[model samples]
Target: IDGFGGLRSKTKVITGVSLPASIESIKARLPVWNFDGSSTGQAPGEDSEVILKPQAVFRDPFRGGSNVLVMADCYTPGGEAIPTNTRAGAAALFAQKPEEESASGPRRPSHRAPRRSST
Candidate 1:
């Protein structure tokens, strides 16, 4: 104890780094775009979010996918997790992709192969 009821010396350590690629990109882009968090220019209900961008924060940039990061206000009043909304939104977005259909039909043989005069 030094003087005013406080500890004198202490040591701190870093365990891990868990920043996502998307978030890192956002932070990097901040200077280029000059995005200010002013109310007039920002998106609706953006101020209510804790972690504004989840995918951006957790994604790996080197892998190279999902250029845009989506942030959803998915929290409940009771602090309970709501996964249904997020899952549905992702599903809807995924459905937009076009699927290829096969043009070939099933083949059926007219006769059996060379059964030597069984009759």
Candidate 2:
């Protein structure tokens, strides 16, 4: 995961206003279990932070059964998009020095196949 092309930052928050009363209550009772940076200016009660809880809907499309979705806070800053889940692709492109020592060449493709002629 080192030497990613660029740094990517992203933040995901689940607020109470987006969920039902049940979720809000749950968050009120157990705010520690909720994601951080979710403070939505809601008043802080004696024991509750008046925060919103994520929606608690369970619907599975692949399994065709009830499922629970747990929300998480993901922060990715300047993250480079690397397809095929290749870690090496995320790193900086390798350049080769050519006739000009001051300049370098572009990264060559990792995989190349011989050309084929169509009949």
Clashing pairs in 1: 20-57, 23-56
In candidate 1, what are the lDDT values of residues 1-119, reduced to their tens digit? 21133322222222443345446555443211111222222223444222222222234355445433333323333333233234435545556753733232223335567768867
Best TM-score among the predictions, by candidate number:
1
Candidate 2 has an lDDT of 0.31
Which residue ranges in model 1 land beyond 4 Å of their true spot?
1-15, 18-36, 44-51, 56-91, 96-119
lDDT digits (tens) for residues 1-108 of candidate 2: 112333322233444534444532443432323222223221223322222233233333554422224332222222323132232232233223233332222333
How far is each candidate from the true structure, as Cα RMSD in Å? 22.7, 17.3
Residue 26 lDDT (model 1)? 50
TM-score of every prediction relative to native: 0.18, 0.17
Q: For each candidate in the order shown, give its overall lDDT on alpha carbons.
A: 0.33, 0.31
